[model samples]
Target chain A: MKVALVQDTPRLGDVATNLEKTVELLEEAAHRGADLALLPELFLTGYRLGDLVPEVALRLDRPGPEIERLAAVSRRIPFAVGLVEESSHHLYYNVAAWFEGGELRHVHRKCYLPTYGMFREGMDFARGDRIRTFPTPFGRAGLLICEDAWHPSAATLLALEGATLVFVLSASPLRGLGVGRHNLSIDTWVQLLTTLARFHGFPVCYVNRTGFEDGLGFGGGSFATDAAGNLLASARDIDPELLLVDVPVDRTRDMRFAYPLLRDERPELVHRELGRILGRTEETP
Target chain B: MSAPVPLPMDAPELTRQLEAFLHEEITKAGFSRAVVGVSGGLDSAVVLLLAARALGPENVLALRMPHRDSSPESLAHADLVIEKAGCPAETLEVTAPVEAAREVLGIEDPLRRGNLAARVRMIFLYDRAMARRALVVGTSNKTELLLGYSTRWGDGAYDLDPVGDLYKCQVRQLGEHLGVPREVLGKPPSADLWPGQTDEAELGFTYDDADRLLWLVVDRRVPPAEAIEQLGLERDLGRTILERMRRTQFKRALPLVCKVQARTIGIDFRYPRDWGL
Candidate 1:
């Protein structure tokens, strides 16, 4: 139930340095007795490689040596690191490699690609289609990327799929006074995720990166909250730091029972709403 | 217009075209009158001139909001231009509101009091606009806008900006072309929020330096370090310009809205206002 969130900088287009830092942070987390550790988005190549993506992208199965080493290292505790994964037809993906029990448990690709000013993820990589939960020794776990965390569908679907805990990996840019004013966004993110958790009777772990990359800074205020939306742990702003929190399933169940958001079943209407986004072709009664 | 040097195209012709364009946009937005703060600085002078040409001098109202410590010459310059442009002018000294707000909020710092001055000016401008059913004409130039120099919800608040695109130097040229007073065009540009508080003194970079660098970085889309090298400017100055651009992003965005439902606005459903045909 103990988790560690790493707030470290990724050197631009330097995969070797990124992996080295990831291993060092994972070791540090394990030393602190953390059962699970999370890293940032695109940690292998950093976030500044706009055109270097093709050169740095590694095939999913072609990450053979790196995956093997990380899996072996995960024998002590479960770890997740962000990287570029090459899929079928040579398409690239921003993927999270979840390692546990000396093996690769799941490779989750980022679903949402922010296409606003200075971001063109949709043009560079393919979108993730699958939305499902993976069984972990701790609970039914789910994964999401940076922009994915902003979408209600990503987390809501995961909750509907019976995930007791959700892990969100992000690499957001900082914008001085304007950006700091939205510090409550971290709290808002946790609130919505916890609302889903309480509605489905679960907990959520939201992780984010810290420091600047190519003049774009990260606030690094990563946090975890229970089903009742209480802050279990929080990190500092604009710095490299990690926080470990012990989240219990019994706590979620007890709070959910008291809140009874789950007991007030309205699945019929909610499913109809989901049908709208899924489209008429994919809808079922 | 022809007297201003280096004019291949007559400044009056360019001013006419820009004014016509402004009129069209204002009509499209369903507005007839404009309210602007006249500081006697180059930026506001150019804006007031443009507003007079766009919406007529009679329809353009100039508010001279000066603090207690503001230069008397600023008011003189503003009055001269107001007379020359044939526009109606009003004066609202900011001492009363500033003192009252400082006492109520227990604000002791001079900087906080200056911000209150900016907010008071905005409040008066908006009040005039509301009473006349006009739009508050903004006078911030490209340099200040790019550097994020204006206070948010204070001087930064405006309904329509007539001169936000021109740099400070360009504004001075345009002001001269539009027949703004010589003293007004020659004087240093400041917000006049506080006594003897010059813009360049606080910004640590001259308007000319900031404008040239910003023009290269934004209009030319050149990299920051390379732009600094190409312009032969100081490294720290260039870095400050880039950092300001990055930091002021929120002022350029729509309000943030949490998407509790699919196809919600802001967080999702981010299509153009004119997206679906």
Candidate 2:
């Protein structure tokens, strides 16, 4: 399947303009013969919108006219985009929505909201409690937001639930000069995604935004990896780009059969180890 | 005796990137002007020149603040930068307010007096920033920030910092590239809180040495023991710099909050700085 990752900048707190630009990019991706396109985290409203989140948060369950327009365009090709979601209960969430065939296919609320050192998502949005895969035309796919992919269990759950492809969306900032002329953060992400792909034998599509917001600069190095952890393509750093790559859909099954790590999986052992580490059996005072 | 530290990246390229970053940050923050405190040292000199180029000389405000015991050469060097950068400049002596506070508090130590002077200068700069509707540009380089050498809420308080990420040695390289006056660039770096205090004398190590170690230990992610061994640095020096970084970590972060509620301010209820502003 041909997938396109749009690494674009969002003007902070300008939802209408951001949506307009998103639609334009989605059309461009479709024109380039992409079957699916993924955008960066919070692409609809932009990241770093601090207190402006409430004002621009979208109601995705009952999406407004702007989202309906996106759905209309989805009839030509499927796409996933991130936004701040205001639920019916008025709780806010960082969400990625998948639309195909003029309908919302699935929604994944970001499960892990980073709250430490330069991130405050735990305070700003509600955490999702579930990880599941849904069927798409190409294959069964799962979605994980930026911080969610950092946790091993997030992808583990999706893989166990029979996902062949995982999409990771992020708006990570550039930090730390890397070891010997490398960007430390991007290198770290590459290590993480490659490991996830190699271990699970599932293709991972990672998309990150680029551009400056306030004092933070998001480094764009969006990429895709095959089930064998071979890098298929990567976008540019520190610039808006659309990365297109042809992912081999059959590799997931081939690698899974060849490696059989998932087949040898020991969930019960993992559960016991986690119980010991978390002290789940200990009595509370 | 030790191998020389590798020189920083191309100075002109670094200077251009920093200038573009500063320009984009200022204009994107909805401000067309900047206010910088010129200390007649490499760090501040670099910032002043960058701000002048980024925001244009007409939009940059250079404030030269000195305390009573401040070296005369410091002022002269600051004047040289102002003349070269062609930015609007003013001189403000912080003797009165600093002395007034010292008298009220009954403090006699040079450290306390220096901190007071730094805070007083911040007050003057901030007030001037408000009057001119410009942001107070910061001059604290990464070395001072990591070492916590800056006075908290004093010289540390700023609307934005252009050189905070650059190490002290890199600042000098950029200053040279920007054509900062040789008089200012060559001076022994000092806070000038007392008559004869120098940064290297107080810190007990040269910036060149410190920056090299920091690049290895912090940027290169070499283990402290490996860094000390590979760089042939004194074990005490590496330990001391790491210790200083650990001690000053609080200065780098917001005050800790006891998280009793699900969404505590600065903890769980955090948003980006530009969230709604």
Candidate 3:
């Protein structure tokens, strides 16, 4: 299956323009023969929303014109895009919602919102408390926002749920200088995402936003990897790009059978161990 | 600390990022062109060159606004940069306005005179920017910004800053790697306000020393006593840099607003400068 990994600059707090741009990009992706497309975290509203969160947020339950437009495009080519989702309870969440067959299939509110050091997501948005993989035309898949992939447990949970392909969306900032031309943050992410895909025997598609907002820049170096962790497609640094890659489902199947690491995994024992570590099972046994 | 631990230098990558920053911030602010005061020093030179690369040499307007007491070499080095970058430039002397203010106000102190000269240059740059429809970019580095060495609303004014986060030593290192002229990099650092004015002489510490001390205190977040010990610096020297940073806190922030309303700007009323952009 052909996947379009979009790394584009979202105009901060201007949902109208970004929504228009996203529609155009989706049409372009579909024209290019992509089976699916994935956009960066907060792809519609932009990251660093501060007080403008509510102003730009889309109500999922009510299905505004923007959400309806996205659903229409998803019918052309199944796609996932991130946005500031205003829940029915009137709380905001940084979310990635997948659209397919003219319907909202799955939505993942970011499980981990970084609260410190150049980030204040926790202060702005409510945390998502659940993780699940949903059925898609491509097969079982899961979505993760930027910080969610930083924790290994999140990916492990997705793997345990039998996700074959995972899309990790991010608005990661451009920072740090080491030996390479790319900043440290971009380099670190490629390594981390590649390793997780290899361990889980699943294809991981990572899409990050580009351009600066209030002096904080999000570097665009979106990439994708095969099940065996070989980089399939890589985009440029600091520019908007539509990186396309082919997901070899046969390789995923081969790797999962050849590796068989997940086949023998024991989540029940792991849960009990976690309960013991938390001191909840000390006297029960 | 420990000879500053040799700050990392990646000339190509840092150049790429800063240039990209200029393109993003400038165009986002609704201008395709930029104007920067070319002081002939490393900081301004770097800013000008990077701006040229990002916005194209034709788009950047280089201004050399020098006072009467300003060193001749300032103009000469600035010419060299303009020629090398191939950007359009104008040499507007601020001496007339500065002298007018000096005589009318009967300003006797050299310090006050220098401050007047800096602000006068700002007038020329901003006026030209307004006429040319270009945004002014600042040249102050992190060390000078932290120490509040710039005159408020004078050399400190700009629509955007590209070098504010980089330290003086890092700026010098980056300038060298990007093929900045040796004469510009080799000379002692100066503000060129007066004939004999040098930044080190006024600050009482070289950029090397200050950078090492700052890396420990600011970047590493070490306690002053511990950082001073690691740098093998005199307690007084380290203390002065720290004190200067502390004293200049006001320069780094917006004007204070006392709250009477439910929300006040910069206190409770918070939004990004890029809000709605």
Candidate 4:
């Protein structure tokens, strides 16, 4: 599958402007012959919303002009855009909307919401409880938000559900890690992604935002790595750029056979533990 | 020994009081001399001049340790500042040591190489200070300190700091009054890490804007959103500052030590500055 990563800068709280820019970038990627396009996390409303979260968040089905425009733009190539999704009953999510063939196909709510430091995700977003892998025309793909990728359990579950590719929408503030007078710990996250891709035997298409929002900087180190954890495309730091890569579906099957992590799984030790989730424990600790 | 009185931010007597306070601390700490890295940058220039004033020109040693990539202008500015401030000067070419250390550590990246240079300079300053029984005074200003802009165990490491509270721009103003060379003050600020690399060039924000915003956020106690709004800064720029605010918390704090007792170092067992007195 040929995918293009849009490392475009989104204006904070300028939903119309950001959505327009995202659509334009997606179209630009499609024009460049990409079968699919990926935009950074919270591309629709921009990442830094501070106190404007409630005002800017939109219901998942509400066209709201921005969503409709995105649907209109997705006439040919499938595209994924990050947004703050509002549901009924005041439930909000750090969400990504997958648009394919001029329609919204799937909405992936972020499972793991980060609450550390500047991020107070728990106060704003209701956690997503379901893990799903969608069967796209091109391939079986899984989607996760930024913090969700940090959890190996999510990736493992997606892989078990036969996902060959994963798209991670990240609004992770750069924290001045890579470009600073201090030691940058963001590279540690890169290693984590690499391990996840290798273990799951799935190519991870990671996209991150750029520009500063509310004094929080986004280091745009977006990249795509193959199932073997070989980096295919990398974006610049704290700058806007587009990254494109092509991977054949067969490449994943080849890697899985070579590594055989899927086949050699010790189900007796691990899968049996999963059975506890389905059981109601009578004893409380 | 009495506790330091809290001084107003812009009090005119600050310089004199600061000098006296630092001198007393140095004597009590048992250091006979003081060493300062002469970067020719405003931050270093202010600190160097302060050290000279506090502990006479003879007692303060100014070391200009430049790497191979350091600009000649930066070095020349250092010499001019030394001449103007009347402090003793020494130059240590760090290229050989840095190269050897890089080889020994197997560090190959440009970033790590720059960090190694900072650490090497610190090592030289510390060693020379130890030889002279001097303390290495830090040159970092409040802005850089707040942003965690210095490398830990590198620029962040120091025995004492005289100009740690002043912002970068404030340091320039203070340096001017201290009779620092105009050429040194006027020159574009740089760490002289790589060829033609300027501090502002790497930071992606001018020191003036960064420091001003920092004062508003940190000293003035403005919220991140309100600070950006009042400053009329771009959202991305504001976000960048907030991210730095979040990430650099470690730089402003003592290293995290796990607590195994009732009272920890920074958390509960805090003591007055003049506790023993």
Top model by TM-score, which number? 3
Candidate 1 lDDT, tens digit per residue, A27-118?
99999999999888887767755556776687667556766778888998897788888876788888887889998889888988888785
| Model 3 chain A weakest lDDT span, ten residues long | A175-184
Which candidate leads in lDDT? 3
Residue clash pairs of candidate 3? none
Regions of model 1 farther than 4 Å from truth: A176-195, A260-285, B1-277
Better of 2 and 4 by DockQ: 2
Ranking by TM-score: 3, 2, 4, 1
Arrange candidates, best lDDT first.
3, 2, 4, 1
Q: After superposition, how far is residue B6 of candidate 3 from its true place, in Å?
A: 2.5
Query: Which CAPRI quality tier does the interface of model 2 achieve?
Result: acceptable
Steric overlap count per candidate: 1, 3, 0, 15
Candidate 3 per-residue lDDT over residues B8-82, each given as its tens digit: 867787788889899989988888998999989899899998999999999999999987778888889999888
**What lDDT is obtained when candidate 4 is compared to the true structure?**
0.77
Whichever of 1 and 3 has more TM-score, that candidate is 3
Clashing pairs in 1: A174-A217
- lDDT, residue A133, candidate 2: 91
- Ranking of models by DockQ: 3, 2, 4, 1
Better of 1 and 3 by lDDT: 3
lDDT score, residue A48, model 2?
Answer: 78
Weakest 10 consecutive residues, lDDT, candidate 2 chain A? A176-185
- Give the alpha-carbon lDDT of every model: 0.75, 0.86, 0.89, 0.77
Instruction: Give TM-score values for chain A, per-prediction.
Output: 0.88, 0.95, 0.96, 0.91
Candidate 3 residue A73 Cα shift, in angstroms, is 0.7
Off by over 4 Å in 2: A11-14, A31-33, A48-56, A178-183, A211-214, A246-285, B1-21, B49-133, B142-154, B165-186, B200-271
